[model samples]
Target: MRDDSTRNTIIFVVCSLALLLLYQVFILEPAAQRRQAEAARKPAAASNTTAGPVAGTLPGVAAPAQVRVVTRQEAAAASPRVTIDTPALQGSISLKGARFDDLFLKQYRETVDPNSPPVELLRPEGARHAWFAEFGWTGANVPGLPNANTLWTVTQGSTLTPTAPLSLQYVSPAGLTFTRQIAIDARFMFTVTDTVANTGAAPVSLAPYASVQRQGAPAHVGHSQIVHEGAIGWLGDELRLIKYSKWAKDGGMELPSRGGWTGITDMYWLAALIPSQSENVRGAFRVTKAGETNIFEANYVGALRQIPVGKQVTETTRFFAGAKTVPVLKGYEKQFDVPNLNWAVDWGRLRLLTQPIFSFLEFIYRHVGNFGLAILGLTVVVRLLFFPLANKQYESMTKMKKLQPQMEELRARFKEDPAKQQQEIMALYQREKVNPIAGCLPLLLQIPVFFALYKVLSVTIEMRHAPFMGWIKDLSARDPTTIWNLFGLIPWNPASTPLIGQILDTTLHLGVLPLAYGFTMWLTTAMSPPVGDPMQQRIFKLMPLLFMFIMAPFAVGLLIYWTWSNVLTILQQYVIMRRLKVDNPVDQFIARFTGKSRAA
Candidate 1:
């Protein structure tokens, strides 16, 4: 004769914990190892492909060339350059091939340190990772057509600025004049206008092409599930996101579309080639090998344009090379009609919910000036939104707690027959107007919202390097304070230890925030009805610790949000239990501490 209402809850918690552990050990860890092994095998600066030859070439066409290994500084200085100076960007364009290379984001740094180097988005050819955008004209074996190796003469400005655009000109041996006028905006978009004049006796058929090429894998490849790092683009209204390993395995992808954008995107940075909205274009995400080096290219080529003798044709395209901020992307989507450009943020399947959540969180952050506080405020908002439902669930839980004694009596009376016990229990519940399963509704409703917040926080660059209270410098990263070194008070790094260092760093590096979250979770569990079975109770008792360990690797922002949410829920539950006059652990704890009677 035992009350078993909490038995189901214990079983559910235990099973969920087991499944999470199994998934982590069997799926995530192994995949991470494989990626690590693969990354170790691939060397840097192998090779790359191009979108066009000089000014007009077919998409995915590879030009025969060897890039001498050189330092990034040396490669950037190897040729004459056009300085790109903007509030958001600082770099130099290579005049050698009229390539948008040697670009750095002025707004973002390589690390949290203020003096850290700015994020280098585009590197010059021959550098360790040569990633840049190039635009030119390509004709069918037409002599003197601009090719990848063609050196262009600066016909206009010394620098490409938002106010003063620069123009480069290349005259083909076949008497065709290719002029490229490149202009930058206040933000990331770059407008390139390619004009081809047919000075030859015959008409010249040419195509305008642009490409974003990566000579090698990035030094630090991200294996995060939430962030997309590789070739990503929208083709003819279809969004394509291909991982680097998958792209290499599948060779490449090609699609024909009237208008779309193609590019290589990292978690925060993007380098995309947007074709003219008025012209039909072909988009290709290709990975080819030049000798032992693997080349990755995302490019678009507009339909061929005929420039009759003494006539000229102009093809204007756009390039986006900068941070993939939500506002910037959405602005581009609206202003330029870049199809599905907002999808560049990798909002996942819950974009409907995640987008709004992100916007709201961003709105709060703009006012609060601290992302961590914004997350805390967001948790409060979500709790308030679901407060009524949660109150009903907690009230039901209180009724169940009150019915425990009566249920036990009924179970003991019907101990001889299990079916009778279950029936009597159901009838008693119906008589009391209490439903055991009603308590689960609030949790079920929270799953999606919780996941949406996780996605928003993890993928948004705004959360990157966001600081909370002391020792929590980066909200997007795991807690840096480790108990292994007494939370940095010992003046020693746990990572510097030998042998079991990594293991300790992973499992024993409990931070203050996570500890607080664990305590709150434990308190919440303690306030709930106690389980009857010994094993069930033991498993339930261990859930808080187990969950704390599991969530230790999660981002600090997520932990803060969860911890704040738990506090709010605890307060709500306590208030409900008090109103219901139910015997709750919180009341009992306070009574015992104050030496008062443990009575509601």
Candidate 2:
């Protein structure tokens, strides 16, 4: 007879290695390629791509736009601009097409360093990796309608501020008078009121439309799976998400929605258009090509209106382009009557639990003033809530441990009769009033909460660049300190060594938090009832170590939460084991330590 334990252990190790290889091949490799690609590209570089306005194929939507890639300086020099200055924003609006093409976030930085450059949100078209929002009228066979090249002169204010708005005016050769009034709040919302009059001899037909366009996708941010970076919208009581990969694979999406918003979102930033609440509009997430680059656009075309001679049409559209802060999104959702604006955070299918978890975490952070401490507080509250289930789980584990010897004896007596051995063991369990599967109830129940907490920490902007004590500078990121470099004590960069440096960094990132989590996990696993099958027991014993490596690259905030939860579980289980007179790892360790001390 072969030893199944040895075979299983070998199989487990191979499977673990296979998983790591797959992770490297997929997640790690793609992230490296994106980072490398970003580093290689220069914003000032020019391209030979020809571009113009996008004309929608739909009946009412026309005068489509084109794509151009040019230097940032050329973009600025292309047309005169109205400056935008606010508490949280600094950028310019191009007088050409009256587009918001250049913007930066004032309060946020590209890195944790205070002196790092501010985050760039919207950049001009023809600039490398361009992202901007454009609003105008699209008309069928209406030559006088404004296009991207039509230059507008400022009619109201030169500088757009929270207190002062900017109004631009453009007159077509056919005697059409168009005016756009743009206002920005202190934070991220942009309100635009567009009015056009038909001074032409005859009536002209046109439709109002707004679009947020990105010339290309940016580098991946956060864990790509958990953090949404693509098209998202809440239309007709449903939140729709189309990820970038999926968007690229599946060409375009068009939905006829009323009073809804659609936008392209990064992990922490968003550029969205909220159409007027009064009218029905067709919202779309579409992609176009520009010299090998994919241009993504989220746009809406409202109902077409006919303007009689000397008559005018006015419409209001709101655009949000800035940080995806929860409070800010929620405020806009209520104030502007936008439906499910907060859903931009990618709360996932477990939103029922994730949303409240994030809210409570925010509340705790507000009171304690530290997010790391706030997570610890959350773990304690969760443990208290699940105390009863945990107690029952521990009680069941203790009973199972006590029945181990009798179970083995039954197996030996009925070795030749496998069915009889199982029947006898079940009878023994019934007599002892032990529910065999009860030991896993508490852990199974906590899985959803664990996932919810991970999602909150991973996706929320408030947690980005958040710090804990010691070496943890960013809770949203993985721990920076690595065991390979002796936690930076040694003057060496493991990631600069050679071709193998990155592989080493990814595979062996044993930081203090990860190590602590592994130790606590092992302790809790040790307290659990030993498995009856030798093969199962050996595989179970290896699980903690294998999972430690798997989780080592995750956000330290998540590791802190799990480690604290494990510690609390251990304490509770130890107490239950002692009260029930069951032998446990804690008491055994203490006794052995005391005995060795006496002997010494």
- Write down the TM-score of every candidate: 0.93, 0.90
Which residue window of length 10 is worst by lDDT in model 1?
Answer: 47-56
Q: Which candidate number maximizes lDDT?
A: 2
User: What's model 1's TM-score?
Assistant: 0.93
State the lDDT of candidate 2 residue by residue for 63-91, as single tens digits.
44554666777877787888999999998
Q: Per-residue CA lDDT of candidate 1, range 484-555, in tens? A: 888878987777777587668865568888898899999888877765567777877888887787778788
lDDT of 1 at 13: 54
Q: Which candidate comes out best when scored by TM-score?
A: 1
Question: Where does the lowest 10-residue lDDT sum fall in candidate 2?
Answer: 1-10
Alpha-carbon local distance difference test for all models: 0.80, 0.81
RMSD (CA, Å), each prediction: 3.0, 4.1
